[model samples]
Structures are given as C-alpha cells and as structure tokens.
Target chain A: MTDTLIVPTFDEPATEAAGRKLVIICSKGNLDMAYPGLILGAAALGEGIETHLFFTFWGLDMITTSRMENLKFTMLGNTAMHLTQAPKMPIPALMGSIPGMTGVATKMMRKQIADLEIPTVPEMLEQITQMGGHLWACRMSFDMMKLNEADLYEEVEAVISASDFMEISEGAQIIFI
Target chain B: MPTTMIAGRPIDVNDEGFLSSYDQWDEKLGAELAKLIGIDMTEAHWAPIRFLRSDYPARGETATLRRASTVGGFAIKDLFELFPGKPAKKMAYIAGLPKPKGCV
Candidate 1:
C-alpha cells in the first residue's frame, strides 16, 4: 500500500485576509444616485479590496458615454412619488413629466451630495476606474438599449450577463443602488 | 471653551459639552456625537467613528465642510438613503444639528 499525503486544492486561496469582494449594482441615471456606488466601490478598491460594479437596466445608461454626458433627470418617468412608501420605491413616470419636477429632484440630489461632500457620478467613476475597480456592463440590458461598445466609457472592463454578475457577486458585499 | 470653524462656520466646543478641540477628539465627544446621530457606538459603528476622528483637524485649524461632511453625511445617509438604484438618502438633520450654545 502506498501512503501519500493528500492536500485539498482550492482555485482561489483565502490567503489574502484583508481583501474583500464588493459588487455595486447601479440602476439609476441620476448623478447623485450614481455617485455613492462608484465612490464606495473606489474606496473599497483603495483599501485593496476587489471591487466590481455591475450596471444593469437603466443603470447601463449611466455607464455609457453616449448617455452619461446627456443624462437627464427624467421626472417625466419617475415612479417613486406615486409608488408605495417602500424605501426602494421607483419614481413615477407621470410625475417625472411634471414641469420643474425633474429639475427640483435633480437640484435636491445635487445639494444633498454637496452637503454630504460626496463626489458626483462622473467624478466618482473617473476616480474609481483610475484606482482599479472592475466595471462590468450588463450585456442583456446593453443590448436592449441598443448601446454599442463605443457608447460606453473607455474604462469598462466587459459587457457580461447577469449570471456572470451573480458569479462575481458571490462572497462580496452586494450593494444595489 | 474653545471656538473653532468647520467649513468657515463657527462652532463652539463648549456648548457641545466636551473638551474636544480642533486637534484631537475626546473619546467622550465621539460618544456624544454618535448619540446625537442616533448611532450606538458599538463594535459595528465604532470603527467608522475612529476613522472620522483620525481626520479631525489639528489645533488652530478646521477641516473643510466637504471633508467633515463625509463623516456626518455617511451617518445621516446610511440611515436615510434607501432608494432602489439610488445613492444613500441625504439628511437635512445633519445640517439641523444644534449649534453650540450662543453661537449660530
């Protein structure tokens, strides 16, 4: 009988104790809404953690340069005001169309971040990517929107599916914003 | 009572009822601040406070409102911002915190 020592092999060892995987899901076009996830993900990256931002649905719109530069505060389509009082309510599309509503919401959001000293979405993304955070664009959503690769920011890591996002999200702090 | 400025606005340290100065934050002051924001300075919350204190301005100087707001904003926003696909909610309460007695 041959006696041999058997050692289990794990593809990704847990050798790095301090590193963490954080995935932020951005589904809004508002700069205010976009900033927090980008900034936090960047901060996590700065701390040596592995960070990923999965842009899906409306969020895919924000990551694309074609729309980001012209991003609108679409009060005409906001569903949150009429939605149930659940914390994660959507902005009412009808209300979003109301005159001045979009501007009001936009200004309010900007002011709040100003008061809190949080960076804007463009600024946050610029810093986050420069700092090494992995950014993924949802392929299905991107396709649904008909956005081409050229429409996206230069730093986009890849256009992947939800399953890929789920696989990346495992073991990481998942933030849906 | 030491008088200081945060973001060019004067804040009285005495009215805050603690000996914390611009340089170092007193542990007791941190506890009071945590309470004012309705946060329990427990294992989960203490580290952030410690991190904030580390950014406290040195004596005879003040931290930018932009910088200090990060700490205050995170505290308020964490409790408030909760929209789907939205950033943390902004808090008006942070701006409403009582100013030092006799100093607006």
Candidate 2:
C-alpha cells in the first residue's frame, strides 16, 4: 500500500500527539563516529520518536556481524581523539603511529564508556531495535563489500537503495554522522 | 495513579489512559477501550491487540509498527486504518498495557 494510506490525516487530538520521525545516516565506521548515530538513535527512540538508522560505506561495518562487536578506535591522524582524551596536551602524530596505539586508545575509550554506564555499540543497537527503531543497510555498499544479509546484525531490517530510503524517510528529520 | 470507570468497572490507568495492569485486561475491557477511542474492534484490530498482549509479557517491550506489521502479520496500512490516528498507542491501551515506552 502507499504511504499516504498510513499517514494520519485525522483531526483528532490523539493524531496531533503522534511522535516525530528521525532518520540517521551512519557514514563512518570508526569507533568514535559510530557512537553518535547509535546514541542519537537510542535517544530518539527513548523519546517516543520513530527512528531509522541507515548505514552506508564505512558505516556498513558498524552493523556487520564480524566487525560491529570488534570496532576499534585509532589515534593515528586523529587529533580530535587526543584533544578529547587530554584537552590541554596533544599527543604527537608520531606517538599515535606507534604499534598498538590504536588498540590502547580503543581500550581506553571502551573503558570510559563502560565507566560512564553508556551502552556499548552492540547494546545500543540492540536496545534501539528492541525499542522499535528501524535499521537499514545501504544496498550499494552491501554489494560493494560483497556482503550478504547474513553478514550483518539481525537487527538490520533491510538492505535498501538510497531512493527507497528517501521514500521511506519522507517528512523525517535526517541526520548524517 | 489515575483511574477510570469503564463499563461499570473502575480500572487504574496512567496519565495517558493506558491500563495500568496487564492482568486487568480482557476482551471486554478491550472492546470498551476501543469504543472509548472511537474504534470498532475488528478482526484486524484484534490481531495486533492480541499480539501485543502476548508479546509484551514475554519480551518486556512493545513492538514497533514495523514489527507489528511484519511479525504480527498485518499490513501497516491496516493498523493505521484500524486505529485511525495512533495505532501503537491505541493498541497498547486496548491490550491493557501501559503506553508503550518510547512512544509519544
């Protein structure tokens, strides 16, 4: 059926109280970039908003079964990471390039998130899905990666074309991360 | 902590008029609620309502519209037509559950 059939057009007060819709695009796969989309999606879901997360390009990895649980943070070429970790003192790029620096940073960041009681990526994604948020994978990226649906988390509702996403996301507030 | 008398029985509800206790829900109460919300309980309506009633206690969460449509075996448009304006909220109420968390 057409979307118009489901879109509420009633004048009742209850109709006016309907929740808003949010569409988030996760284009980055880095551990740091992944949180924004997941966090915002969770927050939106918590607020009664219908939330959709579209993962594309590198972001597709964030939803992949193989990579999602093992996502890592890298300090190399990432000045923002140093700034966040030590606002006043910057770690030199050479230091970040050291072997195992990325692992160290990833561990530290994971610990911080845990200590803060923030849900880890898997937890966040699962909660979002449980709360009824929609997760979509980009069709183009899925093909480019030679990935199949089984490669991604079961929470992903579908692998959709951008045009289809646009159609589904009509009137939604879109955010790109 | 608000209560409303429906069909001569006093029932507790939240601020949004959802039944405070799942145990208090029955087909009679559901029909009463549907009437109060200007809906006529149909087979279509009962599908989601029954699904929610069973799923909530098992899963401890309300199903989203998509889930209801997909797993509950109803079209999204059918749900909208059944409840008219707010299918999710209406389904929860009719099912005698609290307003599904995260629903506006």
- On TM-score, the candidate that comes out on top is 2
Q: Give the per-residue lDDT digits (tens) of candidate 2, residues A49-113.
A: 67899999999989999999888888877766445646889678788888998899899889988
Q: State the weakest 10-residue window (summed lDDT) of model 2 chain B.
A: B95-104
Model 2 residue pairs with clashes: A48-B102
For every model in order, the TM-score on chain A comes to 0.69, 0.86
Compose the digit string of candidate 1's lDDT tens values, residues B1-104. 44544333344444332333443444554454444444445553444344344544332222222233344453322321221111110111122221111100
| Native interface contacts kept by each candidate, as a fraction | 0.00, 0.02
DockQ of candidate 1, scored on C-alphas against the true complex (2 decimals): 0.03
RMSD of each: 15.7, 9.4
Q: A116 in model 2: Cα distance from truth in Å?
A: 0.7
State the displacement of the C-alpha of residue A146, model 1, in Å, after optimal TM-score superposition: 1.1
C-alpha DockQ of every model: 0.03, 0.07
